[model samples]
Target: MNLFTKYLHSVTLSLSKGIQKIACLLLLSIPLFTQAEDGYKLWLRYDKITDKAQQSYYAPRLKTVYADLSDPSVKVAADELQLAVKSLLGFTPVVKAAGTGSQGLTLTIDPKTEGINEEGFSVSTTPKGIHIKARSGAGVLYGVFNLLKNIQTGADPNVTSSPEIQRRLLNHWDNHNGTIERGYAGMSLWKWYELPERIDPRYIDYARANASIGINGTVLNNVNASARFLTHEYLGKVKALADAFRPYGIRVYLSVNFAAPRILGKLKDADPLNPEVQKWWADKTKEIYDLIPDFGGYLVKANSEGEPGPMDYGRTHADGANMLAAAVKPYNGIIMWRAFVYAPDPKGDRFKAAYEEFKPFDGKFADNVILQVKNGPIDFMPREPVSPLFSAMEKTPVSLEFQVTQEYLGWATHWVYLAPMFEEVLKTDTHVKGSGSTLSGILKGDTFGYKMTAMAGVANTGSDRNWTGHPMTQANWYTLGRLAWDTRLTSESIADEWIRQTLTRNNAAVETIRKSMMKTREIYVNYTSPFGLHHVMGEGHHFGPEPWLDKAARPDWTAVYYHRVDSTGIGFNRTATGSNALAQYPGGLVEVYQDEATCPEPFLLWFHHVRWDRPMKSGLSFWNDFVKHFYEGARQVQDLQAEWQSVKAQVPPEIFNNVEARLQTQYKEAVWWRDACVLYFQTHSKMPVPAPYKAPERTLEEVKKLVDIYHIR
Candidate 1:
């Protein structure tokens, strides 16, 4: 070859090598861009603060951390602060054992401390540094989280707080085989197959997230429990999880099958009165406590949905609860007996079933037994009067059980922020004692002077990369923990805090997201169950619309039973002439609910049936207003999409894209709900689509077929 040709070949090889190096450098930098917004960290994301002024303020305050590392939880707290400081303030704090110095942050557990309970903590800024004092190690851990949260949100750190309820827990409806009942995010966070021998690091992250939100206990199995979970095999798996979570100040609880003695112990009848059954339970409780000394307790769903209870043996619920209470009382564990019992009586009002069954045995419950009542009378409807039992059960400790998982609120597909619903239910005046007797006060054991109090949220978390399926749904889990810790907090304040921590801290972006989140629940209710229409979704999965679901396994399970849509009008009449369910409420609510004129419009159809021609307060005919809500809800979802689009530049690309896709699906579903409900209910009312609003593009038959496809599984 010629010399000039050789020179050209060498030049080409050098250029190719340079281009490869550039490509490799770019590939290496991809993580730097993606890691900040992948959402795997949840709201606990401690990415470095962008504002230099805020970083300067926090760095000096947390220069050195000193805590008594004797307790495992306290050591975790110390480690957590150091890690958070390094991430948020760009410097690792010098963490040291206690008694080293009082010049920096000092965390102490002092039983003699005033104005704080066992799990409460007080943080105050001093001349030397910040000092945190709590009655126990758990409190120190909570205080550390509280301080970090303040720094993250750019708030003053001086605060004293305690969980108003004794036990704040998340009940997982997760089965033994890794499938969660009504869970939409993914299969389940607990890898049952890999457990006991191989502990998943995700378990620690779950514990950290729960502890950060002040959730202290978790029911690790489904309420529709399998007796296999009670076996020694599963107990060993639970112990491994308990060991991982203990350092985070989280205790593990189990949801037991009431018929465990019959299924697992090979007993006959499994009667609460039977000595063999009693002995079996006592031994099981002792065995569980032996493996997990800090085992919280048992959550039982008995005599509900065909589950076994003492009633199967001709005994009352109190008889069943007291038996289990006796077994756990020695270990300071409590029994949370669910009051979700109902029978398939075509002639009976399902709303009155729970109140009838549980009210008579209010004071009969054992001291350690807390009757767990759902927030609504009928299984977590979009909206309902707070359960009447919340007013009637004055003697028994009643813990409010809220569904954080959106089983009835469109599951993971629809974006519904539930804190508002929770706030509304909690603030409602039960008026059992007097006018000021709110459900919040009742759960706090304040009005009734009960010995113990607790609150449980049916967990929404799963194995999804973002924890909850929709990016925004994480706020619901956050809301549950915050409200369970202190019900008095306004939903708006909690949303603000969550937005600042989880999303971008830009003021404009925060407001836009907040407005959309705050309106989400109402928007969902409007589209799906406006004017108190409920249980009208597709059966089984509870997705889309099924206003024409007149036939089901039972009459009460069908939509026709609740809506009562006949040729004359719509809505179930629960007044004196109807079911008289209003009589179960306090006298004040009974008087108001009985009168259509005085009953709130939101609950209008829930208690009374009115004619289609009747005029509403909005001056539109009943049918028109109802139809208007459906259309308005669909339009609002479009608005939500627009609002989300407006904040695209401010949000991280991956999170922004993830939420954008969900919002698009939500808009389409909202339209589906609108078209389906309007078309089907229009057939009964025999009315037009109303003026200025176009009729659904599809026929009723077409909409029904779509719902049929959705329920094919």
Candidate 2:
């Protein structure tokens, strides 16, 4: 009741409130000190929005989520929405059972939605709230991710999406020992030593990222498969991964060693026609299905690079594929038979081998068998015409196999946006059926009628903190997934969307990054292997430059076998006078490619062996033009450095610095490629270094030594 007592009570309460406010501020500041952009989040960074108006708009609309948890995928969709809303809008959304007339986002499986495929979804803004509807749980997961993506990029949510191909998968060339075959991004993501029990949280994130872009399947092992993956022990490990990925709708597939019956089962011979061998595979398939019921099936790389196959037993590819297809067919599974076969003949053209082998058996493969052909006739070269097999196999359902690992694109050091390269191959006119017979059209079953369709990318992911070794290479993985979902997406638009979600959202920064990415692949090709000049990479590792490699296990594996450079001219002669590889294509393209004058300049060298002094359409001599590309490619990388430097202030310091360091490495490597290729090739051409470009400071011997130091054969 006294004035002094009342004043003391008021002071005590005021001090307590002030102390509580200070403690809360300290707790909030802890994240600022602890959190840093390390690229581990990838493009799904759901950090709180800094933009006040956008945050306000999203916060209220995403206050609640109505989803049916009975379906595991719908529960996953709900969980993702809650996490994203909490991170992006600073509050977790209350989740309710589906069919509730609540003013919140709705996740429902509406099979009646028109034009929506089994794995496709539609998102629309309703009067009550945003509605995401799909025919399946897989589609609901995809729709939820797309809805979140729209919120981040300020995109319209009223959209429907269906994958262009039925099977969009990532082929991981991971060995049982955790090493990736051509992987530059650290070690493999699968910790084989610890799997089957201790599942890495990264596996879940991996599935989430793939699901966001609509990748429905994954081949977990390398094409040069170890028979161990099929063993009961490894199947448990694979089942663990499959379980982690199942909620995201990603089914796990295996690349089986064809000699598993002999190697793993201790059979006398792994003959496809043998009853014992067939029964062995059937038992294995049943065992696998028992462990993982949704197993996607088998991806076989048989009779290539000394791998065992039906050919080993005097049988055909169809026999090998059909034998395995029969086992999986009982479970409605399919087989992806790789068409990357090459003969060991010293004098044969590697380009003609696949067509020669598979063309005859085009219609002989089992109905469940799909021929997985590389984008180019040769391996995943920097530039080559679309594979003849795409047009050659009319009766077989062919799937386009693309390598997103950047084995030839300077590994992880150099920046090369592969969307343009993928778009280029997909858009190439195959001329099989008509003018509009594109490679994409064929894979979509538009050009060739097929019961199934698929497109696969060799994954570039690894255990690195960034997932991909180089930050920019992550975009390639993103691009492959996006293009697989819808081949019609432009490379530019995909780059824009990725930049906004992953990097700085500033319009200027996005434009600069986009422009840099657009020119990245061309610059890489120019420096490494310009104008359809394929292979020529270091022998075993396929890194750096080795245009003069003449010695290898097989002649076809040698760089000299491909470039065929001599004192008089350069390039392979694939026309009628040479290997006659041009005949493999349709008549319309064959006529154009047979003659050097009519051939597209990019592919001129691929089809013709032009004289050193041949005049080019650029008004420069062939040798001079070739030299110009190498020099200009290196120069463009310098420009990329300058462009990146200008945007340093706009991007996060961690990401900006990471990319800036790589750009520096890229420039040095570009110069190394330019100097090495030009100096070595000049020996055969006997041409002077053209004007406006200085001769390389290092001699050919010095560059050779550099290759030795890098341990590149």
Candidate 3:
């Protein structure tokens, strides 16, 4: 029997036990449903569908489930769905182990008996109820999850819905030491210590959640990869995790340590141009694929932040990417070469670095290589202008990399919803291929008709009881997958969908949460670092504001470097007089961003620094407008807080309490941010408070003292 057969057998056995457990408890009460439970199952609540019409319509028609019940996990999916339906809808279907036997709800294998692909699944409505079809049992599992999702979304599950994107992936920046960089939840999910010896049940649920979101790929290790994972020992451990994810349409990827030839193979130089180095990589690539045939290839972060790469050999990014591309080409895998590289060796404007580097190598990449660029230039800042590189690289197949983890956006402390921020960047016109140019259009390859496109979210998940530390933060992960599948999706639409599913089905509660979520990012930008004021956070941890310091080794490392706050004015000067960074644009984007009058108010401070007395195009002086925005942004959060309070009764107190507590945190931090920023800048601007606005309660020295106190100074 193949892998699917074994999985099906395991599922059959698990079902028999669950059914037996239910039979014995037939006289007992409804699911001794515990008050406290680990949120390992994610949003697949599997709650009993209490609606009589839904139960009646779905229960009987979903009677006899069918799939090529060969795989144990596929069988588990079949059994689990059957069990959930039986328990919730009060009806259980007699499942056909295999084949489309003249029956109700046939989730049959497409070819009936043959090899099946990992990531494809199709669901159709049978006259009975549903027919989940796929080439592989894992695909069947994906179909089951899709079917369940429709039911949860209040949509009729007895319909067809397929994914628009071929690849939906999660790039886990997890380290080998099990430390996830910028991870807010807890420890890494891959317990490398217990891995090859023991498999955790949470692994199944991890795959299940991704499958639900149509996510089909995961890069296992951190991009700052360690050489140990490339060894045979770790490959075995990876194989086990790969085995678990394989059943849910997810193919495992690794962040390959670039210096492997030198570190692992004892080579003198790890140059991409060297034949000996090339041979070693090809052999290593073959070794990895041999261990896990369905591996999804590599993610490299070379020549950035001190990581070694083809740049060391004096070659371009194409040389590095194509070298790896050549290594994995035989296996039909692709290389995701990150476009995050910058000469951190200088204090020069880091915002201008990516565009300077990658624009030179526009059409130099291999067909299978996708250059993954961040949504913004300087990490994931709160109010950053959409990355100029998004519009600059016309000939490259680019995948916009977005951070789902709240690394800089309040880490796990603040409730900052991110869909609106994503919408702003995706919808931004780069003008790379003329006026209608957008980040989405660039990714779709219409500008130059590139080979491929992808969007990856740095996963926020960890070993926390609630997947993300903040309960409502799951919306970030959900929003990413939704948008990746359809870039045209509106932030409000994604927020509403997530609110309905994650928070409540109640329209009032949904609307209230949606309203808060849509404005959450902007509100955050307003009170925290409004109007293109980027990188104002404390160094390394980036938890709080610290724009005054300038002691960092590199200019880019200091928030003061990006903000360029001076007695004259504030904000980085990327125009002709300063960095002349505007020349990077292909067309009139330079014109659009050059003058503060034409620049969008949100990004005005990002591109150009003006004096406190300089009148804004809005007719208000710079100082007056800046303070007004901070105050206005704070008031919006207050508005959101009041809106949430009104619909408190619609949601469960357990969930509501979690969010209410966070909003309280958000409100407090908003005040802290507003006070700290306005007070600090006022010292430089020497401006009085704009009339009708409140002055700071504490001094700038006071805020700095609080930060110093937190650092245990």
- Candidate 1 lDDT over 399-436, as tens digits, reads 99999999998788788999999999999987788788
Error of 3 at 324 (Å): 1.9
The C-alpha lDDT values of all candidates are 0.89, 0.90, 0.78
TM-score, cand. 1 vs. native: 0.96
Candidate 3 residue lDDT tens string, 142-215: 66876776765567564344444556789998887888998989999889999888899888878777777778
Q: For candidate 3, what is the TM-score?
A: 0.89
Task: List, residue by residue over 505-592, the lDDT tens digit for candidate 2.
Answer: 8889899999999999999989988778989988889888888889899898888898889999889999989999999999877876
Model 2, residue 534: distance off in Å is 1.3
C-alpha RMSD for every candidate:
4.2, 5.1, 7.2
Which candidate number has the best TM-score? 1
For model 1, the stretches where C-alpha displacement exceeds 4 angstroms are 1-36, 100-102, 711-713
lDDT of 1: 0.89
Clashing pairs for predicted structure model 3, backbone only:
4-70, 4-71, 5-70, 5-71, 6-72, 7-71, 7-72, 7-73, 8-71, 8-72
The weakest ten consecutive residues by lDDT in model 3 span: 111-120
